[model samples]
Structures are given as C-alpha cells and as structure tokens.
Target: MTTDNRSTLFSPLTLPTPDGTGFALRNRTILSPMCQYAVDRQDGVATDWHLQHYGAVAAGGFGLLTIESTGVNAAGRISPRDLGMYNETQEAAHRRLVSFIHSQGAAAAVQLNHAGGRASGKPWLPGTHGGSAPLEDGGWQTVGMTDQSIAKGYRPTTKLSKDGIEQIVSDFAAAARRADAAGYDVIQIHAAHGYLLHQSLSPLTNTRDDKYGGTEENRFRLTREVVDAVRAAWPDSKPLGIRISATDWVAGGLDVDVTSRLMRDLVKNHGINWVDVSSGGLVSTPLQPSGPGFHAVLGAQIKRALADTDAVVSVVGGISSPEQAETMLRTGQVDAVSIGRAAMRNPHWPAMAAARLGVPCEDNPAAPQYWRAEW
Candidate 1:
C-alpha cells in the first residue's frame, strides 16, 4: 500500500496484493489478533465461540478482523486448545468463521504461528508445558532455531535440525494453502511476542553457531524462508502480513535499527502488505515502557525506514480510543491501528470509534442490524 497525505483516520488506503489489489479498507480500525484459546480440544478446530466472537467484531465495524494465533502444526500451538490449520477439518471450520465475518462487512484474516519453545498445556489442564503442566497432561517437547528455554521451567526446546527447519517451513506453506481454502482474505505470520520466529530474531533467545543463528542474516533466515514459502503457497490476490516485535527492550537485543532494516528488506523482497508492530516479548526486561502508544514510536520508525516502500504499517499496544488511533494515523505514525483488549471488551468498538471521530454511523462500516444500536 502506498502512503498518501491523509487528513483523518477515516481515509482509505489501498493495499497492493494479488487478490486484494487496490484493496482499500473503509477505516483505519482493525481487530487485532487476540487468542481466544477457545477451540475444540480434540482437533484444535474453531467452534461456536470463534464464529460468534469474530462475527461480532466484524459487525462491530472493523475494516479487518484477524483470527488469533493459529498453529501451523500441532506442536506449534500456544495451547492445545489453540486453533490449527494443519488439516482439512480445521480448514472447513475456519471457512465457516470467515464466511460470517465477510457477511458482516469486514475482511477476514488469520494469524499463522509456531509457538516454538512456548508450546504448552491442553484444554483441561491449561498451563505452560513444564512449569504448570506435566507431559502426562498432554504436553510434548517443543523446538526452536536453537535449544533454548523461554523463561523459568518452560519446556526446553530441541534445536531444530536442518530437516526440522525445512519441515516447519513446509508446514507454514501448507497452512497457507489451508488458509486459502478456508477463505481468509489475508494471512499474518506471527513472529512476535517471544514466539518461535521472535526467539530466533532476538539475540537474547537465539545464540546458536549454525546456519540458522549467529549473524543477523542467519537469525533472520528462518522467518524469511517461511515468508517465501507462505507467499508461494498462498493465492496471489490476497495480502500476506508479518507481525513483529519491533524491539526487545533490552540492550543488545532487537531494536528499531535492526528491525527496521529487516522490515524494509522483507517488504522489498517478499511482497508483505502489512507490518504489525509491538514490543518487548523476547525475554523479561524491566525496560519495557508501558503507556498508550508506546510502541507507536517503533512503528513510526519502521514506517519511516520503509517510506520508499509500499507496505502498510500498524501499531498495537494500549490503544483504547478512536482519538488515539486518529491522531496516530493523521500524523503518519502508522497507516492503521489495531485494537487488542479494547476490541475484546467491546466488539463494536470500531463503530463507536467512528462515531467518536465524528464519522456518521451510516458512513461507518456498521451492519444494518446494528444501525440503530451503534449508528
């Protein structure tokens, strides 16, 4: 998506994607991917909760609604209850959710992820793999670019061999294939929040003397490869996005300079249409500042680095009101703003945001059924 001078957040920006060419969202509001951990325990498939939750968010007037972190493989899930797209059954269930979201007037997207060293727990005994739950509770060994443990007592990861790396890449591509079949308009590769890809990106977590680690390029290799694989498998018309932790908030870890360069290269090479910016999930660091729009600085830094590029940028973290989103977009800090907790609390936040921004209810993206309630 090319950036143009915009007067307000209500203005539309077009995305250059195969299926979404010139795809302009009506507003800047997006329902950020918030994991519900509400899927069928047996198969990790979307159930009634997913349909109703996503449906309400779409009907709430968001221009886009992203399904939470869905695992590409069983072991990649944050929780066994997390949604998965590894098989046909999950794909069929997701199709129903996407259909409902689209019917409510928002484009549907899915966040594909591999929780890596963090894969832990199941539905009944929900907890971290080792600390809170035992292997007998349906946990298993996890993997990462290196054999590293994410926090105290978290499941230790088996360092991914060359074959293991390649297999996961294929897994992501296969998940992309399922996402296409499931009717998602967009796909977001989850490389943030100290997850698999993030652990590889940050020096604090990634410290291997192998092809998949050490240097910045080596650390970035797996994510780039996954992006390439997913792009190849996904349809040309839909947009592919990458969620990134813009900074690790610790010295010698991922920061704006490192992340910006990587993001610039990614957009230039992989045809990524959006970059969702968040921070400080790599390792525990007291340096993580908390406030509304704290991550916007990194988001703006990335946007500036890619000023010549065509990728759209979004910032998430503590963004609560329409005014904040408007200010950020109006000032060119980011092209869009994703509402996380706020959207969860009120699914129709986008519509209310529109009203707060003085956009007429009719002009907003509200459904007819919600016309009177929100308009």
Candidate 2:
C-alpha cells in the first residue's frame, strides 16, 4: 500500500504537553479503559492478570492504553477487587505494568477515579452481574455528592462534607503523584460514568445546595479542582487528559451543548490536552444511543466546540470497525477512536484494522512474533 492510501486511523498524533513539544502516538487508536475486576485479593494492588491483560493489548498495537478506573483511595474503588493508586504498593505494581507497556512501544495512561455512590459494588462478572456487595462480602459504605442512592440496587451514600470533599481532592493529587512515580506517560482523570466527579457534574445526581452544587458553576467546581490538582502533581512534560460523559441521555441532565462548553473550558482554561467523550453513565436509560460509532456525533460536537484549543478529542462507544473509524477521522468527526469491547474480543484489533485499511504489512503495528500470522 502506498502512503497516500494509508488511513488517518493509522496516522500519528501528538497530544500537547505543557512544555509545548507534545507527546507522540504511533496511531490514533486508543484502548479505552475497561475494568477487569480480576484482583483476587481486596488489597487494591494490580495483579498478574492485569499485567497480562494490559500487556497483551499494549503489544497488540494500541498507541495508548488507558488502564481501568483506578481508585484514588480505598473507599473510592468501584468494587473490592478494583485497582487503586493511593499507596506505594499499588504505585510499584503500576510501574511494572507501565514498563512492559513501554517495552511494547506504547504509551500508558491511568484513569484515576473515585466511584462515589457506586463504590462497594459487586464485580460485573458471572453470578454477581451488578448491584452493591454486602458488608460481609467485603463491601463498605459509599460516599457521594448527595445522600441518595445512584441507582435502585446500589446502596445509599453518605453525603460528602466540605472537609470530605477536600480530602478527596487531596487523595486525587496524591494518586497523581504516584502515577508520575510509576512512569505513566499520561494521567486521565475519570470524571465520567456517574462516578464521583460525574456525580458532582450532573444536576440529576448533584442536588446539594452548597458551593459544590446548585448552579452550573458549582456542579463543575469539583471537576475543575480535580483537574487542577492532577495537573499540579503530574509532570508538566506529560499530557493530562480526562474522560467525560457528554450526556445523561435524559431530560434535565447534561447534554452535548453543556458538556461541549465544559470541554472547551477544560481545554482552554485548565491544562487538559485530551478529552475522551463517552455518554450516559450517570444513570441507566434506554434513550442512550447504541450501534456502531454511537458516540461519534457527540465527539464531533465537542471537537468543533474545542476547535480553538489544542485538545485531542476521542470518542468511545460501539466503535468496532476500521472503515468506520477511518471515516470518522477522515471526515473530521473525531481526532481518535477509542476501542473498548472490540479490543477485548481481539487484542490485536489495531493490527487487523491496519491490514484491512490497506496499511503495508511492514508498517502494521502487530507484535513481530505474531506478524507471521496473516491478518
């Protein structure tokens, strides 16, 4: 295949760093952070399963691998088995994973998160599909922006006090520092999917009357603080990013227009260099669109909104096809496409996508050992 025939999906991208030189990616394919919930013990450490799971994806050819929703503190974890970044042991384990990802010629990012009202839930695995885990089963009390339960099956949360919010901010900063120590090339603050930050962002979830709630400015306060804290703790030379749910897919909830303004502010005012657009995790609703490239329209809206800024906008949600991804980039829908369930089904989705898109065999991003197997 000639260079002119090469797809934009296989093109290199540079996410700007504070230093202005920018961080380079081999391609526009990013592995969306997906929880594995494979930690055998509830110690908040990355296990061998994580190493192998992420290592395979790194070698499979993703330009960047965003690790799953990692807890900034023990209580912030989504489940007892979820990974955490608050302690030295977790930091060291993360360092090991980053080393292997770098060895595979891919950049590594950690999605630092606090589940808030969604914490202490059972893993989304067999038998325990969803809902809160019991106290005897290792679940603990959850905290959130309000005292209400996020969903019917989830436990009601203790509303975070002003001091508690301060502590959560500190925990995020400490986790950012640990991520830097672990040699991660990027830090993606997880503000989406109805987690702590998202819980604070949406009007449906945040009914508080304090400075952290009420008006739009107040709803956005916690996210801004988290971004500022993470940026301060992370290296200036490394890019800082965020993942946000663009809409709640319901009335009186966040919509693209609202989130686009938020993304613009985050990119222009804050130090965020990348924005990964996703939607409808704040609450379960049938209104959330599905099918191939469902979030591309939302991403396009955000990209146009942030046209004046240098932020890279990527979208995730049912983006599985190479042609579909190429069409999105070629048509200026999004800067990149984040592969989730598709990548899980085939870790080497990028390599296969490259071949399908007419990229030369030599230029394919597959592991050398597996290159012999035809795409």
Assess candidate 1 and give its TM-score to the true structure: 0.94
lDDT for residue 125 in candidate 2, whole number 0-100: 56
lDDT of 2 at 237: 95
* TM, every model: 0.94, 0.98
Model 2 lDDT at residue 254 = 96
Model 1 scores worst on lDDT over the 10 consecutive residues at 123-132
Shift in Å, residue 192, candidate 1: 0.6
**Clash number for each model:** 5, 0
Off by over 4 Å in 1: 1-7, 18-20, 121-132
Runs of candidate 2 exceeding 4 Å displacement:
1-4
Tens-digit lDDT string for candidate 1 (166-243)? 999999999999999889988999999888999888888888888888999999998999999999998777788999
Report the error of model 2 at residue 26, Å: 0.7
Q: How much RMSD separates candidate 2 from the native structure? A: 1.7
